[model samples]
Target chain A: MDVLKINGKEKEFTAGQFPATLAELLEQLGVEAATVVAEVDGDIVERENFARTRLAPGGSIELVRFVPGG
Target chain B: MASIDEKLRRAVVGVAGLGGLGSNVAAALARAGVGRLIIADFDMVEAANLNRQQYFLDQVGRPKVECTVENLRRINPAVLVEAHNERLTAANVPELFAAADVVAECFDRAQEKQMIVETVLARMSPKPIVSVSGLAGYGKSNAITTRRISPRLILIGDGQSGIDTEPILTAARVGIAASHQANAIIELLVDEIKASAP
Candidate 1:
């Protein structure tokens, strides 16, 4: 199982069983796409490629939500 | 006295997004005569943004960076506006923020925020990055707080508020967060409270 940490919460997903795309990961986690952005290992994943991308073990992922103000 | 204006004239701020927060931040900076602004954002205004955003109905479909630039220039013609219509990334972060006296992290995503914070911290620049968090759906306005994470990093927004499966966000919360960000920037520019400590 691979650990997916968002903000500070950790979740487990079977290796190679998780969605390949960022969007898929968001959907699986029940995250709002409009309010959040994905970062894999400290790099922002473009919205267009979030769905086609795959995750690797020990790789930390963060899903950040956009706040209304600074 | 003259030196203050001169310093302000030479100051450049890098704003990494142009959403509601970024747009308002940039606008406030321009109005304050910050001299130079490097605005970067890759989003376009949707019809849905008219609710509380500073865009008009006619501006829908325009790139956010473009719209913001137009607005900023109109507000202060003497201020320099360098608009970048691309997303800020690791490869470009250095170049984007190289000359900034202060960097405003107006991004909406958490991953990007952490990446940016780490990137700036790992670098040699003394420029401080002020970041925002937790302004979703909006009732916990009083929960919002500001912390100077480091001499060079400040995080604005409520420590307790978040996307709590409720309709919490409204124009009020957004304004509060943005104001905090602006004040942080102004403080960084004028006050060396931590840096100048004897």
Candidate 2:
């Protein structure tokens, strides 16, 4: 089993359940691609590359969401 | 051989939108004697913007970038201004801010804010960006504060007050948030000076 860290929280993912790509990771997390920015393992993953960027098992992720305001 | 004040005068700051936050930040930086300002905004000065933005009523209907340039000149004629009367997108943000020492994120909507932040953080790493969030209503002036999200990103505002829920933007509150952002930018510039000092 591998542990994935998202915004500092840890979640366990077996080899089969682990997301293969950043896009799948975001989808499983219920985060919309439009409203958030993703940084995986200290490197920012561009929105266009989400579907192509592979997620490293046991890696850390930082997802920032923007709320409506000035 | 330049003093900190002289360095401030020679620094170029990019303001990515000319709404309440951008307008005020530009004005403040100009008054602080920051030498060059690069401003971009696709909007015109509407009467509604007068409440919180640093634009005049008579300037309404004029492009915000044009008004900001004209007004910044009045605030400090020695300041050099580069005005862009266009919207900023991920494709253009990098080139537009390439020459800036620090970039300010002052857009109104969530998507626009996210775009600038993402573009700057991903594409313009190490340039430093000061962004605002959740300054929407009145009072609780103390709630608006600055936080360093990372070494390159500084966020200013009460983390929870949003325009979507509050729907009220006042001069005092918005100005406070804008000032917080501007001050944060100045502090970063000063920190650079400190880092390079002998």
Candidate 3:
């Protein structure tokens, strides 16, 4: 099994069961890509590049969204 | 000899909205003796904004950027303020904020906030941006806080209390978040100074 840390929490998945790309992971998590910004392993993944950025085992990802109003 | 406060006075801050968060953040920075400010907004003041925004009753119907400039100057006459009376778009963010040392994302809408943040991150890489989220309604001031997302990005406000909730936005809670944003900017500036020091 492989694991990915999301927003500071660890979630485990079978090997090769993890989403192949950041975009897929976001979709699996039901997060609207436009509403949140994501950083994987300390590097920001630009919105347009989410699909091309691959997720590796033991990787850390942080997704942050706006709080609605100022 | 230049003091640390004087170093703050030498930095330029760009504020992208003049509503609740932007206005209050600008005012806080001005009071803190920040040297220069470049503020932008296209909306005029309305009675509805008086609840949690910085403008007074008399300023309603006036342009927010104009009122904000006047108020900022009143707070610190020595501070230089450049007011832009126009809406911010991704196309103009780089040009408008070219002179800013740090940019504050103070928009009201989620899409707009995302737009500004994306624009800044894409176009102005490495420039620090202090933004807010979730500071809506009253009570539980402790809920509002500041989080550092990256070296260039900081998020402020209670992560959960948004406008979609029950109580509604008020002066106290919003002010707390605004202050947090302002203080975060100061802390970032101090860190920058230290990092650049010999």
Candidate 4:
């Protein structure tokens, strides 16, 4: 099993098996309902594949959530 | 002061929803010479919109975005225009704002306005948003004020004023509110106000 450091949290999961959608990863991370936006390396991941997308080892991710006000 | 030509050349503005406020906002921006604009609205003109919208009776049945682009083009043929004939939602907001130097939230629905603001703020989109609220019924011009919710967010309209109660139709009130919005945007483009300026 390997871990992906997301934003700052390190999540450990079995290596080699990954979801086909990025949305699935969000659900696994308990962040599907968090108004989360995914940015892989410096570009944003389109919503079309968020649910079926997966992550690879050493691929950095940034999950942005909206804050109330402004 | 930056010349009108210089001010327009560097601006990439987005106006969402073309109604009383949005229509006036778009027209004012065009008249002020904004270099580039992205206008989005899925609505079509209704007979009821004859009051404040800068549209004629002949424009009825045309898409708001299309009509806005047409009207703006006629006003300033040299300005660049991109019209999106779609609703503004969370899904398309990012792409809509990706190249925008500034954004205006003209949605009459408070919920929609909140959604757009939250998304822009969350993404740290780097452009300022000029938002509207409380311009429903107008009696006193002094009631309107532009408040800075953050360094990058400016809110127009009167505090605690609801659109439903005010019954917006006349061009006067909507025009005032739109002017405030356009003024804030011009100030934003020319660096007249610091990000810290309220």
Candidate with maximal TM-score: 3
B193 Cα displacement, candidate 1 (Å): 10
lDDT for each residue of candidate 3 in A2-54, tens digit (9 for 90 to 100): 89999899999876779999999989888778877778998777788999999
lDDT of 1 by residue, B1-198 (tens): 335455566677888887767878888877777788988988999887666566778899999988988888789989888889998886788887887778888876666765566566556356678888866555666766777654566778864355444364465677677778877887676654222211
TM-score: model 4 vs. ground truth: 0.70
TM-score-based ranking: 3, 2, 4, 1
Task: Give the C-alpha lDDT of model 3.
Answer: 0.85
**Cα lDDT of model 1 by residue, A1-70, tens digit:** 7676655577778757666667777888777665554567766565656777787656677665544433
What CAPRI-style quality would you assign to candidate 2? Answer: medium
Against the unseen true structure, what C-alpha lDDT does each candidate score?
A: 0.71, 0.85, 0.85, 0.71
Clashing pairs in 2: none
Compared with the true structure, what per-residue lDDT tens digits does model 4 show for residues B77-116? Answer: 8678888999888879989877777888787676677667
Q: How well does each candidate reproduce the native contacts, as fnat?
A: 0.19, 0.67, 0.67, 0.00
lDDT of 2 by residue, B58-167 (tens): 99999999889889988999999988889899999999889888999998887888788889988886788888877899999999889876677788888668788896
Query: Candidate 1 chain B: minimum summed lDDT over ten consecutive residues — where?
Result: B189-198
Off by over 4 Å in 3: B193-198
In model 4, the runs with Cα more than 4 Å from the true position are A1-70, B1-4, B192-198
Q: Candidate 2: lDDT of B22?
A: 91
Which residue segments of model 2 deviate by more than 4 Å? A9-20, B193-198
Interface RMSD of 1: 6.7
